[model samples]
Target chain A: MPRLSADQRHCVRLTLNGRAVEGEAEPRMLLTDFLRHVIGATGTHVGCEHGVCGACTIEIDGALARACLTLAVQADGTSVRTVEGLAPEPGRLSVLQAAFRRHHALQCGFCTPGILMSLDHYLRSHPLPTETDVREFLGGHLCRCTGYVPIIAAALDAAERLRNGETDA
Target chain B: MKPARFDYVRADSLAEVHDVLAAECGEAAVIAGGQSLVPLLSMRMARPKVVLDIMRIPELAGISLDGDTIRVGAAVRQAELLAWSQLKARQPLLALTLPWVGHAQTRARGTVCGSVALADPSAEIPLTLLALRGEVELSTKAGRRRVAAEDFFQGLMSTARADDELIEAIRFPCGRPGEGHAFREFARRHGDFAIVACAAVADGKGVRLAVGGVADRPVARTFAGLGGSMLGQALDAFAHELEAREDLHATAAYRRELVRQLGRQVIEEARRCRA
Candidate 1:
């Protein structure tokens, strides 16, 4: 079989953060690139192109997935939520984001977007999570700073606030 | 790094998959979860001419149980299996091993059949399947057939599947009454590939042991006389025979020790669960 030229591109259409979005991508264009470049949602950071680092984590059809490992074409017709989608509106932090800030959950801030997105999706189902549960959930992500203490605390605190029906500003 | 350009085709049916595989032959790579293949593609480790996306095939999705066997479709993601309460009750070994496959995010997209087909020596899913003596169904343009997990895995990143064959599903025998199962792996980080791992399934009469990350392929053994107390000594003796190789992460000797210790712990845990 002959190798395909790198110039080939496919039309990709997907729902981005509750909005219908369309983009053209090479078959090899990663979902992370499509989210950051074509869709212009730069909040989803890409740390490791490999799946090991969860900095490229996002939600596809409401399930958490690694955007780095998913092709943009694979996400055609799917709903995706990146870190940019976590906030209720632009310029205002969501409850999880506020909790992270209050608890000083970030230092380098490179891993924060993925961690926040992961916790944002996780806390919805696990509103009464324990420290172990938070740790287990955060295990997918790798953070170089903050030693994960603040992050775990932030996640637990956010879970509490969300449980109490706190509104995002 | 971004992957080199390739053509993408989504197969909507089993026939479409077979036809695509037949036409593309060795040039096409199937993309299910894209958990492993996508990484390889980005690293330029794999350069296929075309990538066949099998996620849209309705026939290749869903989980069903028949009397004593549970069938998990190729498109059924690991997260789906983890969330499947009935599967947890029926195949406790899978339930025990699913979380260790990767993280919640990877599992949310990774499929059981994809893991089995990849046949990664360090992956938990293949080791669990080997421990359970599961069967993988392969389909072609002609027909479909089943291969035992033991025979299906040939070597590192190799399997018995032909170029034209697509993995249809995998069938695992339902956990029997009094069957207790435990899975444990030692990795530097939670989601890192294991340095050594073990899965144990035991009843009062016999025990099945499968070890991964210590050799070219995951290995399984059955011992009729083994019990929780005897597992440590038995595994210690068995570890000496493993073809463990030294890698940057660990020495061969260290991996053997891991197999010995983790094997015993899993067996003991299974025994406790049974009791």
Candidate 2:
């Protein structure tokens, strides 16, 4: 592995999914890269790299952020959750992931991880966002396929399910 | 693409950021929220050798009121500022334009100072701030200084912020009881950068019009206590003064028309808001 040069390393310590983690990351290394490469969580995908597409989204300190644009050093002392650690049990999906599958929310699946991350944060904050609100909240994620009609439905369905005490995935 | 390698220094204090900038001279760029800077760096558009991260800086973070002025710390995120009730009432211009900012996810991390400092002509807060006659407080290791929003924006992606200084805060002058402001914009898609935007402030005497994204910088002109036919003539003259750039988003002519339309609409809305 090619280590970040001495000058690029910023000593940072943070908690990742209930575990204390400390490392030196390049100032240039994106938070997505830090999570995937250094911390060994590869579920976070990088899609537009710019903040426009939400493919690289992650939850940092309980807020969704574009991991591709966020510097690793910026996450120092912060708690982060990647899609890989979203659920503990093997052969099972989180409610959102299962919802996406159940409602056919994804087609190509390239944009699913980011959509999942953004919707996770959105549903947590707004357990029951109206259709218009859900449309606006998920506006950042750009899905090249599926036309977003089903994705919108899935989000609404997931919200309804969650509010009705359905957590099984 | 990833950003070029640079040493990141997290400043715990405003003085520390200023000192670091002073030491690095023009080599350092302040990162507050990193919404604008991150893209600029990744695209290699801006290559500052030293990264002075100021999001952690204590002094540049929050929204407060000071002597009838709504003072917003530079590092205060747009979402946080929009959530304030007093900011909503005292600065309705900001509140109305807040939702148009990049969706909830982007607003969560984008800073007010980052938006103003980036000075993107199409951005919402800068033009609204300019129309509202906002003031930017800049601090350097040498001392502190203030610049009116009109003078602060130099041109496209430019501001009066010196290399050795950090934008400390922005002050929106509290509107008098009868004064009113209205902002309107047209974009290809919701939350996308505005193709053309207009912000208007109306007082008893006259209305002031400011248009963004139609020009390289936010341009303003006063109606000079005029309305009816005279107001229409002033708007036409102001539309001609616009220097619009033709980009993939909109043609210069289209943007100029947008400026004219939005300017006219905002003036009408401001009048109604006043009434």
Candidate 3:
């Protein structure tokens, strides 16, 4: 009902990674910036601020979305999950992360966080993914290194591991 | 890449939205899903004094079957529509094209009406709307009106919609007997914007083919009772008439060739699927 002005910051509250967090952001501030600068959750990286690159992907209310394409003011009161939530606990990795490590899916690791977020969401709905399906799904992401071969291998291995109830790493 | 400063308003009701739009007139921009607008904003291509949010309004959500047509509300997300169990049975063309609209990540948040409202020449949603001859329900301070898809899309990123108007919902007709719908797009990447996208509706009378991404707007032509060679010549004429220009991604000759080849292939597929 009330319009939040541009000169002042508005209070935005949302649950992040199973915990409630609050921050103040301008209406023009992107959700990616708010997550990193305001919420201090740097695990969600920013690449190609116009949403072409998938480096800023995250789970918004259980749905995969581009953080660069969402306004922080719009994310208010929503539950969000970043790459930080992927690990089961401190110093531990999820099944997908372990598979990526074993297969060397990432190099330089600039685009790893967003890739991990997307693969994590996809593998849940599609427990059994063929090589073609994995390849097509990875079209949303761009990774200069690994040539996408090892990433595809890692994704399939992670899917099989999850199917076998392998949860911790 | 931050957007310029603007005041944000989240409306809870249609009356509130009307008030805000009536007061601001043409200086406000409506936000829904934000798949396209956000990118433009980040690039500083689109700037407005006020950004209005309509997703909170109860009147702007839900999907319902109204007799022979399926009505998708303005706030209905693309993923929700793609997941609808009755989609294939009701609007098979939409079912075939929704997956091509964007990636799973973007589709999870983008709205159906939002796609039509943006009127992207290379987008799947508007192309499907035109292919099926569907309509979008427009709302403004003056009242509600329905505009046919053909007239709704004017030119490159232009539409008949007014600055103060909002696309309330989009109506897609249900699939009928003896009719088959097929969609094909040739993009460099699966989820990228199309270089040439074609959708064909084949029925008893003739086949209506709609082509996108090669022109400033999606265009459709009906070829009735044409033989193989005649159809090929007609397709060639349509391709040449579009006058597709050269862009960094493709050449004019290459695009016309895709239109000629992909268009004929899609038409055949639609005819084969016709019951």
Which candidate leads in lDDT?
Answer: 3
User: Tens-digit lDDT track for model 1 on A47-160?
Assistant: 988988799889999999999999988898899888877888878999999999999999989998888888988888888999998998899888998999999999889888
TM-score of chain A of each: 0.94, 0.88, 0.98
TM-score head-to-head 2 vs 3, winner:
3
What candidate 2 gets wrong by more than 4 Å, as runs, is: A1-10
Stretches of candidate 3 above 4 Å error?
Answer: none
Pitting candidate 1 against candidate 3, the one with the higher DockQ is 3
Better of 1 and 2 by lDDT: 1
The per-model DockQ list reads 0.55, 0.46, 0.88
> How would you encode candidate 2's per-residue C-alpha lDDT over A36-119 as one tens digit per residue?
888787788888888888888888888778888788888988998777766647898777778788889999888888888888
Fnat per candidate: 0.68, 0.53, 0.91
Model 2: per-residue Cα lDDT over B1-275, one tens digit each: 87877777777777778778888879888888899899988988878878888777677777888988888898899889888878667877887888898888888888887899999998888888888888999988778898999999999988898888788998888777887788888987789899998888898988888888988888877786777888777888888888888999889989888877888899989989998
lDDT of 3 by residue, B177-228 (tens): 9988888999988999998899999998889999989888899988896778
Residues B1-275 of candidate 1 have per-residue lDDT tens digits of 98877888877788888988998878889999999899999999999888988888888889998679989999999989888879778989988888888888899999989999888999998998899998999999999899999999989899999999999999999999999999999999888899998999989887888999998899998877575557667888789888997899999999999988888888878888898
Indicate the residue-level lDDT of B64 in model 1.
94
Better of 2 and 3 by DockQ: 3
Q: Best-fitting candidate, measured by TM-score?
A: 3
Docking quality tier of model 3 = high
Which is better, 1 or 3, measured by lDDT?
3
